[model samples]
Target: MGRILLPALTLICLIAARYLADQVGINGLPAPVGEWIDPLRLSEAAIWLCMAWVAKRAIEVALRRGRNGSDEERIPSIAFDFLGVLLFLVAIIAIAGLVFDQPVSGLLATSGILTGVVAFAVRDLIADIFTGIALAIERPIRIGDWIQFDEGTPQRTGRVVEMNWRAVRMVTVQGRTIVFPNNALSRRDFVNLSLPERHFRTVKRIVVDFSVPAERAADIIMSAIRATPGVVPSQKPLVLIDELVERGTVFSFHFWVPDYPKMFMIERQVVENVLHFLDQAGYAPSYPKLEADIAWQSVSEIDASFDLPDLLHRVPLFSKLSEEERLNLAHQSKEVQARAGQALVAEGDAGESLFVVLAGLAAVHKSVEGKLCRIGQVEPGQVFGEMSFLTGEPRSATVIAEIDSVFVEVERGAMQAIVRENPEIIDQMGEIQASRMNAQEIGDSTDGTRELDDPGFAEKLVKRIRLTFGQPG
Candidate 1:
């Protein structure tokens, strides 16, 4: 686009020089033509220099702010720069012939062999430069895009951090910068991971014995996926029966993540949550009698080290149930654990599981106007997540583990199973939920928090609980 300036500048200078020379007689020279021509040549060169200055400014402005902040229009503008330089070189040759009176035809004739040698020597370099120009124009992969390609090949992988005339630079996931020749990049196949929303789907497979009913096992896996923070909820997770083998059935979990960089961390959390859920369901890995105990506890399972039944007995609400019943409830529970400072239940997260704190301490906090205010402390045997667990609503507060903690989570199905047998447990659970609302000394009462014990609060709480738990009102 800026190439027009070079020709326009040259034409104007030519007309002005011709007018000056014709109007002011040249025959009044004091000395020889060549000696005096040097001074006149300098003056002509000064006029050409002024034109070059204008062309330079025009080219710079057009390249910089022309379109999309320059990057989108980088290719065309750069091509203009290349063409302008070539034209300037041609002008230099003309100036030499006109001002110094050199042989214009002989110079071109003698330079043919030299030009061929230079082209042959820099053939690859020239190809790479032109190839870079082509890529800049086409923009198959722009800067800031993530890509992957064959190792040691011309194709580059990772994020494109640099794009220039000779090469494309990428910073790989491993923290290495790779500079690929532009010509080489043109010859290879690469995957551009930035297209189509940049959402990456990952598949995780788990093997389980035939004893676990397919539907039941799938539910356990799906629950873990739903709890995972990285899983994109917009794309529903898929649980598929991938294969059946002598060992057991292979279940594949396919989930989409918004960011691909956090894939490994998300997968780790899913695997841990799934394994914990499986462990609580009596899939303790043991292999003493593989054939005989295949349907029940077998050698293939890892024994869940946490004593869930004993822990459940420690809770006052479960005190009415017998040891056998506690064990049954424990088996139905999904074991969940969290590290210090990790949230077992985040405020505003939709939850269906009632978390019974089995070990360690936790801090309960409510977000008031975007600021977290500590509401209470949860000791062992205390239950949280009950609001969302029984009501099918979001969590009322965030519970973070004060230390490495353990929890036996009873989801809606497991809670329903227990309530179907014992409806009285609902009243006791309701009383506790009511107590939390009415309690005066929940942590940080110094903020002068008002008691939430409104009239008919317990009735409303029990009503919602009974409805969600499938009890007759």
Candidate 2:
């Protein structure tokens, strides 16, 4: 397609350019020595520039395809640039010879000193061009390579988007563009995160009270890392005891991720989970340094202090679980607080975490007659969003906090781990869900209300929940 289309456009531009030149009476055959400058040539140069661009694009597309068939298409883009330049010079010479009866080569020979002066003026630009060529040949970093440099301080990191004749363009993780001169990169040492695999391990160091057992802290980190969705399972997360600082014991947790762009997001999840786990496991960081660490954390990652295991015990489904099991659930749980009228889970919004009300009350509301009507009150120890969270379905009703509320949010990840450890809970969970659905306190007369007690319906719902949450039989 490119072969047929671009060349035809180039031909059209060539024709139009000649017709315009003829209309303006292109003559006055100025010799190279006679006209040190020619204003008339501006019209001709513009047309040739258009031709070169189109011709370069077409050649690039065609040659890339042709090369891919028989050989490794590692052909550098500079080759295409050279090819287009050669064609442009040929075209300019032919046009100049026809108009002024002197070729560009002859004109250049007469203007040797002028050409050398121009070359010296653009020496920096020429150096960049040559450096870019060498970089393309060396192939240290190709397009799409994630790299980090300026190791001294205020590091620059980004993915290489493109390499032009003079500079390398990179788009940073913080959504900023950085164009570095080729000579700059040629002299500096950069860490290519793309080599071998995109997966790279990042370390997060935390200082905890010295009283806390290192083994326990390491276990908590390992659990969080393994349960994290974006973490690469092939690379096991590691924990190292670096040193005991003035504050507390320093522990470094290393995690591997394949996608560099989502580093912050995945790290946020892991860090938040680690904090929760630490809090639940009766482990606390040294307050002086911990305060600073907490302040640096994103709003979404921060949580008010709460006893996660105790909250999990309040949930009827997890109430019967053993102390160890409850603690594990707590490690995987998120503590969420809601003010009055704040929706815990909204109708038609997809959910994975079951909100177990820990304090205050929430009103269960659903659309009735095109208006949200209060159905029932969810008090302490009661659960909402179980159906949607368990089944990976949209919330059937909106549960808004009637007053200030605290909730023990149990996500699918925690549920999966729970299932993996205790397979027998699947049946119990299904029965509890069915019983809750059939209870009359919730005023909805919809499918979730009426049909849940049906044995087949319960079985199907349980199966779906199991599958969606990655619960193995």
Candidate 3:
């Protein structure tokens, strides 16, 4: 606003001066002064030029507002600037024909040779500017969009940050800013990952041993990719045998993400989870052929450990259980797969079993002021429904699967038997439960609600547990 203030004020002053000169008959005042100035009509031309500048600034301001209205919408400033310059040229031509009574065609024709010489000398710069104008009009990509240039040995992907008459600037994943010449970009084909929509499918390839069945490998990898945190829940992930290689069978894992900028991070997470699941399934990647005899034990104790017992070990409430007890509990437990958006438990619903997340994400929502408000997220290795499991109470919050998730359900019978065998375990479990309650209390404090504190909450919880299980206090 400040930048345009001077130009606007100058225009107003020029108009007022011209009006006063006309009223006072200043055009006929003196011989030489009046004759020279009146014939050129310089005063009127100045007013026209000033008016054009003010109009251009106003148009640019409107363009800025339109660009800021949305994350995906963008309008290049250079396009408006070029239009403003063209406006100035038009105003100059109009003033020459109307005010000075000169022929506009002659003026333009006389400068044709000079324009040709300048164009020839700076042809590359002119091409860039014109290409930029074309791109600005077509708008294949916008600021903050992820785009790929498919010209090199390996394609380059980057987030566009700036665009102008000369170049388009973007920053790559490795944090390097590349200034792409507008003319070059215009000549080549590029892919806009953010166009059509932000969400798009991405794929990663893995090699598995030929000993592993193709269908089984695909199932395992698909599960792993679907359970990844950033995988779009609305789109189902896919896995297929892409090719057969000398080393093994090549499998392609396809998943969707909300945007392209985080593709690398999500791909890494998917790879890590896939490898973990593959290791747990006792299927490692194929090894290179060698002359020596290779002793490969495909089935190991680690593969056996991925059952309910392993998930129990991850929970702090069951961390103290002996391996034998864990195996016993595991025998009585069941592994369940939950589809994305499924509600596992609702607030105030009776549930005698607690679930431990083995993979994928879940969200905890509670009824607050008659509205379901998300309180927290439950990730892999975390536990939920324990409060209801321990005291035989109604569920305190609703747990919904944020993605395709796996969980191990520990039933009441198994828990009661383990607690009876290890009576002292009641106090340990109660303490952990109390700490969790206290954390919830702190979390709710911001909203003026308070829950039980840690001091006597554990003892009270232990008493409730004994009563719920029909055990002596």
Candidate 4:
């Protein structure tokens, strides 16, 4: 609306001027005014130019409306700019022929010669302008698209921000603005990360020791990628053995990221989480080594790979427990393996134990409006089901294994003695459970901070835990 205001006002003023010109005859006007007005036909030329501007604005507005005002479907700005220039040129020629009553054929021929000379002098600029027009029409890459312009070492990736007559401007992932000449851009091969869909598949390769079974490694890596936040979970991410080299076995991980601009952030998170999961499972990435005997885990790290106590140490709920208490809990706990799609716990079911994910992934879901909607994911080292275990309430949410998963289940039987010895541990457990409950109730907070501790809720939770375990009031 703001864009059309100037042109609309100009058109109104031109119409008024034409009306006044006719009412007050040029012959009755002063000598110089009448003399200049008749030859120049100033009023008529002004009216023609104003009409052209108004028409251009109207056409642009109609194009936008045709797309239902969707930013993704709106015509590129370069298209409108080119259309305006073309319309103004046509209006200029109309003024020469009709308003001035002059033969425009000769004028057009002279303009053609002048244009040829200018085109020859600035051929590169003309080429860029024409190439930009072609790109605007073809739309191989649109504004807001992520593209790779140079695919050499240290590849160049940027989001298209603006396209004008001679150049395309993009802001890189590093926040640097880069301008590429349209003709140059058209000549090179480029990749549009956003085309087909904003979600695109990417792969990462990691080397694991040959000592680790390829099937186990593949399962672990697939679960790690699937558990990541930005990954498209419904697509079922895959992992395959790519090669066997001197270092070890190369495994390829394939997953779809929901957006291109977020690719880097997601990649960082995937790597960090994947490595952590592998470490929890007692594996490490193998480096190029010539030695025939390659140890997968060092002597110090071997216990961490297999010991239940080591896994217990990583759980946040057990953070307050002493080393001896954790070992005692570990002695009584049992390891359970669940296949993909298996229900670990069902909503409203009886459960007296909490489970900690040791490998693979699981999803937390609850019945919302008669539909089971997924609420969260469980990754390696994370604990779940404590509310039902501590309070003996019906399971508030159902948890299902997303992939072949391993969990260490600690029943109330295992924890009874530990809590009885140190009642203070109940306070810490209450604090942790209260934070989890707050997170679920609050959803994700925009401020990037969660309610870390809720004393009132914690106090109530402690009582529930004591009652559930038959501890003293």
lDDT of each: 0.69, 0.70, 0.77, 0.79
lDDT of 2 by residue, 205-232 (tens): 8887655555546655665565568998
Pairs with backbone N, CA or C atoms under 3 Å apart (clashes), candidate 1? 284-301, 284-302, 285-301, 285-302, 286-298, 286-299, 286-300, 286-301, 287-299
The numbered model that scores best in lDDT is: 4
Q: Global CA lDDT of candidate 2, please? A: 0.70
The reply for model 3, stretches above 4 Å from the true place, is 1-6, 28-40, 62-71, 150-156, 208-223, 244-249, 276-473
- Report the error of model 2 at residue 138, Å: 2.1
In terms of lDDT, which candidate is stronger, 1 or 2? 2
Candidate 4 lDDT (Cα, whole model)?
0.79
Top-TM-score candidate index: 4
The C-alpha stretches of model 1 lying farther than 4 A from their native spots are 1-60, 70-84, 90-109, 151-156, 233-236, 264-320, 327-473
Worst ten in a row by lDDT for model 2: 292-301
* RMSD of candidates 1 onward, in order: 10.9, 15.6, 6.5, 6.9
Give lDDT tens digits, candidate 1, residues 70-169. 4323443335556556656766676768766889888888999999999999998888889977977777877667777874233345777777767888
Q: Write the per-residue lDDT of candidate 3 for residues 66-182, one digit (tens) a residue.
A: 678564676776697688889899889989898889999999999999999999999998999999998898888888888888642123888888888889998888788888999
Ranking under TM-score, best-scoring first? Answer: 4, 3, 1, 2
Which residue pairs show backbone clashes in model 3?
A: none
Residue 169, candidate 3: alpha-carbon lDDT = 93
Worst 10 residues of 3 by lDDT: 441-450
